[model samples]
Target: MPGYLLVFFCGVLFAAGLGLSGMTLPQKVIGFLDFAGEWDPSLALVMVGSAGVYFVFYRRIIRRAHPLFDVSFHVPTRTDIDQRLIVGAALFGIGWGLVGFCPGPALTALVSGYDKALIFFVAMVTGMYAYRTVDAIAGLRTDEGTAVDG
Candidate 1:
Protein backbone atom coordinates (compact mmCIF):
# COMPACT_ATOMS: atom_id res chain seq x y z
CA MET A 1 0.00 0.00 0.00
CA PRO A 2 1.70 3.12 1.24
CA GLY A 3 5.04 1.38 1.64
CA TYR A 4 4.87 -0.05 -1.84
CA LEU A 5 3.91 3.32 -3.28
CA LEU A 6 6.83 4.96 -1.49
CA VAL A 7 9.20 2.32 -2.82
CA PHE A 8 7.89 2.88 -6.35
CA PHE A 9 8.25 6.63 -6.04
CA CYS A 10 11.80 6.31 -4.73
CA GLY A 11 12.75 3.97 -7.56
CA VAL A 12 11.32 6.36 -10.15
CA LEU A 13 13.18 9.24 -8.58
CA PHE A 14 16.46 7.31 -8.60
CA ALA A 15 15.99 6.35 -12.25
CA ALA A 16 15.22 9.94 -13.18
CA GLY A 17 18.35 11.11 -11.40
CA LEU A 18 20.50 8.54 -13.17
CA GLY A 19 19.07 9.56 -16.56
CA LEU A 20 19.47 13.26 -15.89
CA SER A 21 23.04 12.84 -14.67
CA GLY A 22 24.08 11.13 -17.90
CA MET A 23 24.77 7.97 -15.92
CA THR A 24 22.64 5.98 -18.36
CA LEU A 25 25.11 6.71 -21.11
CA PRO A 26 27.75 4.01 -21.60
CA GLN A 27 30.15 6.47 -23.17
CA LYS A 28 30.06 8.68 -20.12
CA VAL A 29 30.74 5.81 -17.73
CA ILE A 30 33.49 4.43 -19.95
CA GLY A 31 35.07 7.83 -20.19
CA PHE A 32 35.08 8.14 -16.45
CA LEU A 33 36.76 4.76 -16.07
CA ASP A 34 39.45 5.69 -18.55
CA PHE A 35 41.80 7.52 -16.24
CA ALA A 36 44.94 7.01 -18.31
CA GLY A 37 43.21 8.24 -21.43
CA GLU A 38 40.51 10.89 -21.78
CA TRP A 39 39.07 10.78 -18.30
CA ASP A 40 35.73 12.38 -17.44
CA PRO A 41 35.48 13.94 -14.00
CA SER A 42 31.70 14.53 -14.09
CA LEU A 43 30.87 11.10 -12.68
CA ALA A 44 33.33 11.70 -9.85
CA LEU A 45 31.48 14.89 -9.02
CA VAL A 46 28.18 12.99 -9.10
CA MET A 47 29.59 10.38 -6.74
CA VAL A 48 30.88 13.05 -4.39
CA GLY A 49 27.52 14.81 -4.42
CA SER A 50 25.69 11.56 -3.72
CA ALA A 51 28.09 10.71 -0.89
CA GLY A 52 27.66 14.16 0.61
CA VAL A 53 23.87 13.84 0.60
CA TYR A 54 24.10 10.40 2.22
CA PHE A 55 26.54 11.64 4.84
CA VAL A 56 24.22 14.53 5.71
CA PHE A 57 21.10 12.36 6.12
CA TYR A 58 22.27 8.83 6.96
CA ARG A 59 23.04 9.54 10.61
CA ARG A 60 19.77 11.36 11.22
CA ILE A 61 17.80 8.68 9.38
CA ILE A 62 19.42 5.86 11.34
CA ARG A 63 18.82 7.60 14.69
CA ARG A 64 15.09 7.11 14.19
CA ALA A 65 13.57 4.18 16.12
CA HIS A 66 11.93 2.84 12.97
CA PRO A 67 11.82 3.56 9.26
CA LEU A 68 8.83 5.24 7.66
CA PHE A 69 7.66 1.91 6.25
CA ASP A 70 9.32 -0.74 8.39
CA VAL A 71 9.54 -1.84 12.01
CA SER A 72 13.28 -1.18 12.24
CA PHE A 73 16.14 -0.14 10.06
CA HIS A 74 17.90 -3.03 8.31
CA VAL A 75 21.66 -2.56 8.49
CA PRO A 76 24.65 -4.71 7.68
CA THR A 77 26.32 -6.36 10.67
CA ARG A 78 29.56 -7.52 9.11
CA THR A 79 32.46 -5.08 9.17
CA ASP A 80 35.42 -7.35 8.53
CA ILE A 81 36.73 -7.75 5.00
CA ASP A 82 37.29 -11.29 3.74
CA GLN A 83 38.60 -13.04 0.67
CA ARG A 84 35.13 -13.59 -0.77
CA LEU A 85 34.34 -9.89 -0.41
CA ILE A 86 37.57 -8.92 -2.09
CA VAL A 87 36.96 -11.34 -4.96
CA GLY A 88 33.39 -10.13 -5.43
CA ALA A 89 34.50 -6.51 -5.44
CA ALA A 90 37.21 -7.21 -7.98
CA LEU A 91 34.68 -8.99 -10.20
CA PHE A 92 32.25 -6.08 -9.97
CA GLY A 93 34.95 -3.55 -10.80
CA ILE A 94 36.15 -5.59 -13.77
CA GLY A 95 32.64 -6.00 -15.10
CA TRP A 96 31.87 -2.31 -14.75
CA GLY A 97 35.11 -1.32 -16.43
CA LEU A 98 34.65 -3.73 -19.31
CA VAL A 99 30.95 -3.15 -19.99
CA GLY A 100 30.48 0.46 -18.87
CA PHE A 101 27.08 -0.50 -17.43
CA CYS A 102 26.48 -1.41 -13.82
CA PRO A 103 23.14 -2.87 -12.78
CA GLY A 104 21.20 0.36 -12.07
CA PRO A 105 22.14 2.27 -15.18
CA ALA A 106 21.90 -0.83 -17.33
CA LEU A 107 18.33 -1.36 -16.14
CA THR A 108 17.48 2.30 -16.80
CA ALA A 109 18.93 2.10 -20.30
CA LEU A 110 16.74 -0.94 -21.05
CA VAL A 111 13.70 1.36 -21.33
CA SER A 112 15.37 3.07 -24.29
CA GLY A 113 15.37 -0.26 -26.21
CA TYR A 114 19.15 -0.44 -26.35
CA ASP A 115 20.36 -3.88 -27.46
CA LYS A 116 23.60 -3.66 -25.48
CA ALA A 117 21.69 -2.78 -22.33
CA LEU A 118 19.34 -5.73 -22.89
CA ILE A 119 22.31 -8.04 -23.35
CA PHE A 120 23.96 -6.72 -20.21
CA PHE A 121 20.73 -7.17 -18.22
CA VAL A 122 20.32 -10.74 -19.47
CA ALA A 123 23.93 -11.51 -18.60
CA MET A 124 23.50 -9.96 -15.17
CA VAL A 125 20.42 -12.09 -14.51
CA THR A 126 22.25 -15.20 -15.64
CA GLY A 127 25.16 -14.37 -13.32
CA MET A 128 22.75 -13.93 -10.42
CA TYR A 129 21.13 -17.31 -11.11
CA ALA A 130 24.52 -18.93 -11.42
CA TYR A 131 25.67 -17.51 -8.10
CA ARG A 132 22.50 -18.74 -6.38
CA THR A 133 22.92 -22.19 -7.83
CA VAL A 134 26.53 -22.42 -6.69
CA ASP A 135 25.67 -21.13 -3.24
CA ALA A 136 22.87 -23.67 -2.86
CA ILE A 137 25.17 -26.48 -3.87
CA ALA A 138 27.80 -25.34 -1.38
CA GLY A 139 25.19 -25.08 1.36
CA LEU A 140 24.00 -28.60 0.71
CA ARG A 141 27.53 -29.92 0.90
CA THR A 142 28.14 -28.12 4.18
CA ASP A 143 24.88 -29.40 5.66
CA GLU A 144 25.66 -32.99 4.63
CA GLY A 145 29.16 -32.79 6.11
CA THR A 146 27.84 -31.37 9.39
CA ALA A 147 25.18 -34.07 9.64
CA VAL A 148 27.73 -36.81 9.05
CA ASP A 149 30.06 -35.34 11.70
CA GLY A 150 27.22 -35.04 14.23
Candidate 2:
Protein backbone atom coordinates (compact mmCIF):
# COMPACT_ATOMS: atom_id res chain seq x y z
CA MET A 1 0.00 0.00 0.00
CA PRO A 2 1.12 3.57 -0.59
CA GLY A 3 0.63 4.47 3.08
CA TYR A 4 2.78 1.58 4.25
CA LEU A 5 5.47 2.46 1.70
CA LEU A 6 5.38 6.09 2.76
CA VAL A 7 5.75 5.06 6.40
CA PHE A 8 8.73 2.86 5.56
CA PHE A 9 10.37 5.64 3.57
CA CYS A 10 9.77 8.14 6.36
CA GLY A 11 11.28 5.74 8.88
CA VAL A 12 14.36 5.34 6.69
CA LEU A 13 14.65 9.09 6.34
CA PHE A 14 14.32 9.52 10.12
CA ALA A 15 16.95 6.88 10.77
CA ALA A 16 19.25 8.52 8.26
CA GLY A 17 18.77 11.89 9.91
CA LEU A 18 19.54 10.41 13.30
CA GLY A 19 22.69 8.78 11.93
CA LEU A 20 23.87 11.94 10.16
CA SER A 21 23.21 14.00 13.29
CA GLY A 22 25.38 11.64 15.39
CA MET A 23 22.31 10.79 17.45
CA THR A 24 22.86 7.06 17.06
CA LEU A 25 25.97 7.30 19.25
CA PRO A 26 25.49 6.93 23.00
CA GLN A 27 28.55 9.05 23.63
CA LYS A 28 27.05 12.02 21.78
CA VAL A 29 23.85 11.89 23.84
CA ILE A 30 25.71 11.35 27.10
CA GLY A 31 28.01 14.22 26.29
CA PHE A 32 25.01 16.49 25.80
CA LEU A 33 23.67 15.48 29.22
CA ASP A 34 27.02 16.01 30.90
CA PHE A 35 26.66 19.61 31.98
CA ALA A 36 29.29 19.66 34.75
CA GLY A 37 31.68 17.66 32.59
CA GLU A 38 32.54 17.88 28.88
CA TRP A 39 29.24 19.04 27.50
CA ASP A 40 28.36 18.84 23.79
CA PRO A 41 25.92 21.49 22.63
CA SER A 42 25.87 20.25 19.04
CA LEU A 43 22.96 17.89 19.69
CA ALA A 44 20.92 20.89 20.80
CA LEU A 45 21.16 22.15 17.25
CA VAL A 46 19.71 18.90 15.99
CA MET A 47 16.85 19.04 18.53
CA VAL A 48 16.08 22.67 17.75
CA GLY A 49 16.23 22.02 14.02
CA SER A 50 13.85 19.06 14.34
CA ALA A 51 11.42 21.00 16.55
CA GLY A 52 11.50 23.97 14.19
CA VAL A 53 10.73 21.82 11.15
CA TYR A 54 7.98 19.96 12.99
CA PHE A 55 6.49 23.23 14.26
CA VAL A 56 6.26 24.54 10.69
CA PHE A 57 4.83 21.39 9.14
CA TYR A 58 2.50 20.44 12.00
CA ARG A 59 0.68 23.75 11.62
CA ARG A 60 0.38 23.36 7.85
CA ILE A 61 -0.71 19.70 8.10
CA ILE A 62 -3.45 20.36 10.64
CA ARG A 63 -4.92 23.08 8.45
CA ARG A 64 -5.43 20.60 5.61
CA ALA A 65 -8.74 18.72 5.24
CA HIS A 66 -7.02 15.45 6.01
CA PRO A 67 -3.68 13.69 5.81
CA LEU A 68 -2.49 12.11 2.60
CA PHE A 69 -2.61 8.64 4.14
CA ASP A 70 -5.31 8.85 6.81
CA VAL A 71 -8.99 9.75 6.81
CA SER A 72 -8.60 11.93 9.93
CA PHE A 73 -5.93 13.62 12.00
CA HIS A 74 -5.09 11.42 14.96
CA VAL A 75 -4.64 14.05 17.64
CA PRO A 76 -4.65 13.42 21.37
CA THR A 77 -7.70 14.86 23.12
CA ARG A 78 -6.34 14.46 26.63
CA THR A 79 -4.95 17.68 28.07
CA ASP A 80 -4.61 17.11 31.79
CA ILE A 81 -1.27 15.87 33.05
CA ASP A 82 -1.80 12.89 35.35
CA GLN A 83 0.24 10.42 37.41
CA ARG A 84 0.69 8.01 34.50
CA LEU A 85 2.14 10.75 32.31
CA ILE A 86 4.52 11.97 35.04
CA VAL A 87 5.72 8.47 35.87
CA GLY A 88 6.19 7.54 32.23
CA ALA A 89 8.10 10.75 31.51
CA ALA A 90 10.35 10.18 34.51
CA LEU A 91 11.06 6.63 33.45
CA PHE A 92 11.80 7.67 29.87
CA GLY A 93 14.16 10.40 31.07
CA ILE A 94 15.96 8.06 33.42
CA GLY A 95 16.40 5.43 30.74
CA TRP A 96 17.60 8.00 28.24
CA GLY A 97 20.05 9.46 30.75
CA LEU A 98 21.43 6.04 31.66
CA VAL A 99 21.71 4.32 28.26
CA GLY A 100 21.63 7.42 26.04
CA PHE A 101 19.50 5.43 23.64
CA CYS A 102 15.87 6.32 23.09
CA PRO A 103 13.72 4.07 20.87
CA GLY A 104 14.41 5.81 17.55
CA PRO A 105 18.19 6.11 17.95
CA ALA A 106 18.45 2.61 19.42
CA LEU A 107 16.54 1.12 16.48
CA THR A 108 18.72 2.98 13.97
CA ALA A 109 21.90 1.92 15.73
CA LEU A 110 20.73 -1.71 15.80
CA VAL A 111 21.49 -2.03 12.05
CA SER A 112 25.16 -1.15 12.74
CA GLY A 113 25.56 -4.26 14.99
CA TYR A 114 25.98 -2.24 18.16
CA ASP A 115 25.77 -4.58 21.13
CA LYS A 116 24.48 -1.90 23.47
CA ALA A 117 21.81 -0.96 20.98
CA LEU A 118 20.64 -4.55 20.76
CA ILE A 119 20.55 -4.89 24.53
CA PHE A 120 18.65 -1.63 24.92
CA PHE A 121 16.22 -2.60 22.21
CA VAL A 122 15.47 -5.91 23.88
CA ALA A 123 14.99 -4.28 27.27
CA MET A 124 12.81 -1.60 25.72
CA VAL A 125 10.63 -4.19 24.03
CA THR A 126 10.33 -6.20 27.20
CA GLY A 127 9.33 -3.11 29.11
CA MET A 128 6.70 -2.27 26.51
CA TYR A 129 5.23 -5.76 26.65
CA ALA A 130 5.26 -5.73 30.40
CA TYR A 131 3.40 -2.44 30.43
CA ARG A 132 0.81 -3.74 28.01
CA THR A 133 0.28 -6.87 30.05
CA VAL A 134 -0.11 -4.89 33.24
CA ASP A 135 -2.38 -2.36 31.60
CA ALA A 136 -4.58 -5.04 30.11
CA ILE A 137 -4.97 -6.80 33.44
CA ALA A 138 -5.60 -3.55 35.29
CA GLY A 139 -7.66 -1.78 32.63
CA LEU A 140 -10.41 0.46 34.02
CA ARG A 141 -13.81 0.72 32.40
CA THR A 142 -16.69 3.07 32.98
CA ASP A 143 -20.13 2.04 34.18
CA GLU A 144 -21.11 1.51 30.54
CA GLY A 145 -18.09 -0.83 30.10
CA THR A 146 -16.34 1.67 27.85
CA ALA A 147 -12.55 1.88 28.18
CA VAL A 148 -11.33 5.10 29.71
CA ASP A 149 -7.98 6.82 29.16
CA GLY A 150 -5.61 6.95 32.10
Candidate 3:
Protein backbone atom coordinates (compact mmCIF):
# COMPACT_ATOMS: atom_id res chain seq x y z
CA MET A 1 0.00 0.00 0.00
CA PRO A 2 1.03 3.58 -0.53
CA GLY A 3 2.07 5.69 2.43
CA TYR A 4 -0.96 7.97 2.25
CA LEU A 5 -3.22 4.94 1.85
CA LEU A 6 -1.77 3.41 4.98
CA VAL A 7 -2.30 6.61 6.89
CA PHE A 8 -5.87 6.88 5.65
CA PHE A 9 -6.63 3.30 6.58
CA CYS A 10 -5.18 3.83 10.03
CA GLY A 11 -7.31 6.90 10.52
CA VAL A 12 -10.41 5.08 9.33
CA LEU A 13 -9.77 2.21 11.70
CA PHE A 14 -9.15 4.59 14.57
CA ALA A 15 -12.33 6.54 13.89
CA ALA A 16 -14.31 3.35 13.56
CA GLY A 17 -12.96 2.11 16.87
CA LEU A 18 -13.89 5.37 18.52
CA GLY A 19 -17.38 5.21 17.06
CA LEU A 20 -17.92 1.57 18.00
CA SER A 21 -16.67 2.23 21.53
CA GLY A 22 -18.97 5.23 21.95
CA MET A 23 -15.93 7.46 22.33
CA THR A 24 -17.28 9.92 19.75
CA LEU A 25 -19.91 11.01 22.20
CA PRO A 26 -18.94 13.61 24.74
CA GLN A 27 -21.55 12.33 27.18
CA LYS A 28 -19.67 9.09 27.41
CA VAL A 29 -16.40 10.87 28.20
CA ILE A 30 -18.09 13.28 30.56
CA GLY A 31 -19.82 10.41 32.29
CA PHE A 32 -16.51 8.68 32.83
CA LEU A 33 -14.93 11.86 34.20
CA ASP A 34 -17.78 12.63 36.56
CA PHE A 35 -16.72 10.01 39.08
CA ALA A 36 -18.50 11.75 41.93
CA GLY A 37 -21.94 11.74 40.31
CA GLU A 38 -23.63 9.33 37.91
CA TRP A 39 -20.40 7.74 36.89
CA ASP A 40 -20.09 5.47 33.87
CA PRO A 41 -17.31 2.93 33.67
CA SER A 42 -17.68 1.81 30.06
CA LEU A 43 -14.93 4.15 28.94
CA ALA A 44 -12.59 2.30 31.26
CA LEU A 45 -12.89 -0.76 29.03
CA VAL A 46 -12.00 1.34 26.00
CA MET A 47 -8.95 2.69 27.77
CA VAL A 48 -7.87 -0.78 28.78
CA GLY A 49 -8.33 -2.14 25.28
CA SER A 50 -6.40 0.73 23.68
CA ALA A 51 -3.68 0.46 26.30
CA GLY A 52 -3.34 -3.24 25.63
CA VAL A 53 -2.84 -2.64 21.92
CA TYR A 54 -0.32 0.12 22.64
CA PHE A 55 1.57 -2.09 25.06
CA VAL A 56 1.77 -4.88 22.51
CA PHE A 57 3.00 -2.80 19.56
CA TYR A 58 4.97 -0.09 21.39
CA ARG A 59 7.90 -2.42 22.06
CA ARG A 60 8.07 -3.53 18.47
CA ILE A 61 7.98 0.04 17.25
CA ILE A 62 10.62 1.18 19.71
CA ARG A 63 12.91 -1.72 18.84
CA ARG A 64 13.32 -0.39 15.32
CA ALA A 65 15.36 2.78 14.75
CA HIS A 66 13.18 3.73 11.81
CA PRO A 67 9.65 2.93 10.66
CA LEU A 68 8.62 0.68 7.78
CA PHE A 69 8.76 3.62 5.37
CA ASP A 70 12.36 4.43 6.42
CA VAL A 71 11.37 7.64 8.14
CA SER A 72 12.97 8.39 11.48
CA PHE A 73 10.57 8.16 14.39
CA HIS A 74 10.35 11.58 15.90
CA VAL A 75 10.33 11.52 19.68
CA PRO A 76 10.00 14.32 22.15
CA THR A 77 13.24 14.72 24.13
CA ARG A 78 12.28 17.52 26.49
CA THR A 79 12.41 16.67 30.19
CA ASP A 80 12.06 20.08 31.76
CA ILE A 81 8.71 21.49 32.80
CA ASP A 82 8.96 24.73 30.87
CA GLN A 83 6.36 27.47 30.67
CA ARG A 84 5.28 26.65 27.10
CA LEU A 85 4.76 23.00 27.95
CA ILE A 86 2.90 23.88 31.13
CA VAL A 87 0.63 26.37 29.41
CA GLY A 88 -0.09 24.07 26.48
CA ALA A 89 -0.97 21.21 28.81
CA ALA A 90 -3.22 23.45 30.88
CA LEU A 91 -4.99 24.66 27.74
CA PHE A 92 -5.43 21.10 26.50
CA GLY A 93 -6.89 19.99 29.81
CA ILE A 94 -9.25 22.93 29.95
CA GLY A 95 -10.49 22.25 26.43
CA TRP A 96 -10.92 18.56 27.16
CA GLY A 97 -12.81 19.13 30.39
CA LEU A 98 -14.92 21.92 28.97
CA VAL A 99 -16.20 20.07 25.90
CA GLY A 100 -15.26 16.47 26.63
CA PHE A 101 -13.57 16.66 23.25
CA CYS A 102 -9.96 15.64 22.97
CA PRO A 103 -8.27 15.67 19.55
CA GLY A 104 -8.80 11.98 18.78
CA PRO A 105 -12.53 11.83 19.43
CA ALA A 106 -13.04 15.34 18.19
CA LEU A 107 -12.14 14.10 14.72
CA THR A 108 -14.24 11.00 15.23
CA ALA A 109 -17.17 13.09 16.41
CA LEU A 110 -17.29 14.84 13.04
CA VAL A 111 -19.54 12.03 11.91
CA SER A 112 -22.23 13.15 14.31
CA GLY A 113 -22.73 16.47 12.50
CA TYR A 114 -22.93 18.39 15.74
CA ASP A 115 -22.24 22.10 15.49
CA LYS A 116 -20.61 22.08 18.87
CA ALA A 117 -18.08 19.49 17.74
CA LEU A 118 -17.28 21.56 14.68
CA ILE A 119 -16.82 24.66 16.83
CA PHE A 120 -14.63 22.80 19.30
CA PHE A 121 -12.50 21.37 16.50
CA VAL A 122 -12.07 24.79 14.93
CA ALA A 123 -11.06 26.27 18.26
CA MET A 124 -8.64 23.41 18.81
CA VAL A 125 -6.95 23.93 15.42
CA THR A 126 -6.80 27.67 16.02
CA GLY A 127 -5.15 27.07 19.34
CA MET A 128 -2.62 24.71 17.78
CA TYR A 129 -1.73 27.17 15.03
CA ALA A 130 -1.44 30.00 17.52
CA TYR A 131 0.87 27.93 19.67
CA ARG A 132 3.02 26.97 16.71
CA THR A 133 3.37 30.58 15.62
CA VAL A 134 4.29 31.68 19.13
CA ASP A 135 6.73 28.82 19.59
CA ALA A 136 8.47 29.50 16.28
CA ILE A 137 8.76 33.20 17.05
CA ALA A 138 10.15 32.50 20.57
CA GLY A 139 12.45 29.63 19.46
CA LEU A 140 10.77 27.29 21.94
CA ARG A 141 11.78 23.84 20.78
CA THR A 142 10.24 20.87 22.54
CA ASP A 143 13.44 18.82 22.13
CA GLU A 144 15.57 21.43 23.88
CA GLY A 145 17.23 19.13 26.39
CA THR A 146 18.01 16.05 24.31
CA ALA A 147 21.56 15.37 23.14
CA VAL A 148 21.38 13.41 19.92
CA ASP A 149 24.13 10.83 19.58
CA GLY A 150 24.78 11.61 15.94
Q: For each candidate, what TM-score against the reference?
A: 0.87, 0.86, 0.78
lDDT of 2 by residue, 13-120 (tens): 988899999898899999999899898998999999999999989888899999998998777666666665666678889999997998888777778897778888
Displacement of residue 67 (Cα, Å) in model 3 is 1.6
The 0-to-1 C-alpha lDDT of every candidate, in the order given, reads: 0.81, 0.82, 0.81
Relative to the true structure, candidate 3 has a C-alpha RMSD (angstroms) of: 4.1
Off by over 4 Å in 1: 133-150
Distance from true location, Cα of 142 in model 3, Å: 6.9
lDDT of 3 by residue, 5-98 (tens): 8989998898889889988889888998888979999999999999999899988898897987757876555566776666667877887877
**Which sections of candidate 3 miss by over 4 Å?**
132-150
Better of 1 and 2 by lDDT: 2
Instruction: List pairs with backbone clashes in candidate 2.
Output: none
How well does candidate 1 score on lDDT at residue 40?
Answer: 87
Error of 3 at 50 (Å): 1.4
As for TM-score, the candidate ahead, 2 or 3, is: 2
True-structure RMSD, every candidate: 5.9, 3.6, 4.1
lDDT of 3: 0.81
Q: Of the candidates numbered 1 and 2, which has the greater TM-score value?
A: 1
Best by TM-score: 1
